[model samples]
Target: MRNILVTGGAGFIGSNLVRELQVRHPEARIVVVDDFRSGDFRNLRGFRGDFVTADVSRLDWNAQFRDEIFDAIFHEASITDTTVHDPYLQAHDNIEGFRRLLRFAEPHQTPVVYASSAATYGICSGVQEESQPAAPANIYAFSKVQLDNLARDHARRFPAWRIVGLRYFNVYGPAESHKKAAASMIYQLYLQMKAGRRPRVFRAGEHCRDFVYVKDVVAMTLQALNAPRSDIFNCGSGQAVSFNEVIAILNRHLGTRLEPEYIDNPYAFYQPHTQADMSRARAELGFTPRFTPATGIPDYLGSLSPS
Candidate 1:
């Protein structure tokens, strides 16, 4: 049987990826390693897999698994809160945790597909590309950039091992309620509309993001793991949409014409725009994002309703 390990499997994207992995490889032995720090255990409900309750930063791999080998490793655990100002904590968990995983993978020559972030391109002017210079505006972005740099070094040292990093843009979908304030703006808007309140936005709500759906993110992640090359690629829809457009889409889906309440922007390090250049991902990993807000909001909102 195939063996796989997913860190942060109780978190939003990680849980979704766990579900997809189970479906695609039914006979595979999937082991989830999560500390339950920012993740909700309910996200893993109905999941058939072994759960290892431990922080990635402090995991004792040898003590738990002994000499068991893994076919692939999905490294998703990290300090993802951008508003957090704790650089030391970010470096310890996000950076040091990855270093530990790399050491584990090196001996096994296991393929690793890890989560990077678009935050690395804090204020890029044009389409964000993998080859462009990294400009981190916050500690969270700095952590991801550090991870990517470490991945590059690992790739060079272990030429035969696959170490792919995906610089994910704004990702949204089901199983993200656990994120709360950290959830996608799309989800935040949905909740506001459900409560009969106007969804709030910053200033004119024109700031754009290349919001890629969770399903697409999962698909691309799998592709990255299986790809022949070890490199970092941008994971996004390759199309930028304004926050106002997202609110409009939510309004249309919920059948409520509620206007967005504009407020003063509080984030001094806010990114005004982001659009992924998909050529690299397409050419390298055969990744094509399948969701846009217009096409995806209805299904997403429907999933939120009580069944």
Candidate 2:
């Protein structure tokens, strides 16, 4: 727990997680791994630490770990966009990277805390629980399901290794700079609104997602890392907010703004009415998210302001 490796540490959630960990464990040195493609360098630039700029899925962890031993590894590296699905690349990165990391951790006994997705719960009617079993609808969701299953099987075989995966809900805040439409819509929409454009909404504006704030996500993630429960937990506020509601919240903060423009569901991939059943996370590991979108939006906007 002293020295940690934050894969995709320069990205949205990982960047914030690293910052939180630095303050909580001030003496601890964090090693950040980022390709900085879809992940931005701006997120990592503010943090004080060493970094490795390379594709995580391709890197040989055994050789990488030969120099230093990581007490914990946060495996956040993955291809997230559903619009751009190259099965070969997705499987290799999302699926294979996990196996490689597991193999590396086999000898060192360093526990892994990796990012799973709420996307994996694609098209579910009710709140998704760890025990309910996942039926992902897209390649992105499928990849995480595969990783979770792989981790489970591997854990059974190698009883010594402890692996944790988090099903992160709609994570949003500063430093989320992914430009793709499928990325954090809140941030993208905010920027668009600030520039006198309305935030686009899904066809019905009825699709709901558990929009968990960045800071809460970071705190819960650290707790999971420290607790080492060796289980996959859903990280979210467990409340659903529709896209229409999100635009209304934005308008309220900015003193009346453009009305949301409805559009066709662009991606043929998957969109679900997403909410998390975080009972397991709260009861077992003592994790409770503090920020709701309504309360979080003002601060989020304030932080992003150039003034």
Candidate 3:
């Protein structure tokens, strides 16, 4: 049986990835590591796998799993909140945590597929390609840029090992309610409209983002395990959708015509536009996002309906 380790397996994308892993690799021995800082136990409700609750940055990996050899390590733990301004906290947790994981996996030369955020692009306009230089706008994104740098250096030192980094765009789907404020705009908007309140957005709601579905993100993540070479790829729906379009879609699905309540922009670090350039992902990872807001929103909403 395959042995797999998923850090942050109790969080949004992590939880979805964990459940999907169970269905795809039922016989695999999956061990989840999470600190529950931003992760919630409810996200792992039906998960039937060994779980270790500890901060990956501070955990003593060798002492905890002395003889275990993992077939793959999916490193998803990170300070994902973009609004967080504390440099030391974000850098320590995000960068050092990944560093420790790399050290643990180094001796075994384990194949690692870790999460890299599109936030590294910052306010860069046009299509976001992997080759473009990183322009991190906030401390959270800066930490991810450091992660890619670390991954590159590690891959150089250990050429035989596979270390694939996926730069995920805005992802949303089921099992994300636990994220609350950090959740995707789609989920936040749905909640407002569901409660008969006007959906809120930055003034005019013209900002655009590549809102890829979590299922697609998980699919691409799984595909990275088989990557032939160590590299980074952008994971997002190739198309961009505007915030105004999202409100329209939500209104149509919920059968409510609630107009959006425009508000002043609060965050100076907010990116005005983000659209992934998926040409590389298609050629390399054979990944093409299967859902756009037009289709994904309804599916996500239906899943939230008391089933």
The candidate 2 region of ten consecutive residues with least summed lDDT is: 177-186
Candidate 3 residue runs with Cα over 4 Å from true position: 267-269
- lDDT score at residue 28, model 1, on the 0-100 scale: 96
What does the lDDT read for residue 289 in candidate 1?
85
The residue-level lDDT of candidate 2 at 135 comes to 78
Q: Which candidate wins on lDDT?
A: 3
Kindly list the per-residue Cα lDDT of model 1 for residues 59-118, writing each as its tens digit. Answer: 877778889999999999987677678888888888888988888878888899999999
Q: Hey, what RMSD does candidate 1 come out at?
A: 1.2
Screening candidate 2 with a backbone cut-off below 3 angstroms (N, C-alpha, C), the clashing residue pairs are: none
Mark the 10 consecutive residues where model 1 has the least summed lDDT: 298-307
TM-score for all models, in order of appearance: 0.97, 0.93, 0.98
Which pairs clash in model 3? none
Query: How accurate locally, in lDDT, is each candidate?
Result: 0.89, 0.81, 0.93
How well does candidate 2 match the true structure in TM-score terms? 0.93
Candidate 2: tens digits of C-alpha lDDT, residues 114-194: 899887777776677888768777788889999999878877877767788889999888778663565587887787788
- Candidate 3 residue lDDT tens string, 140-231: 98999999999999999998999999999999999888888999999999999999999999998999999999999999999998888999
What lDDT score is found at residue 76 in candidate 1? 91
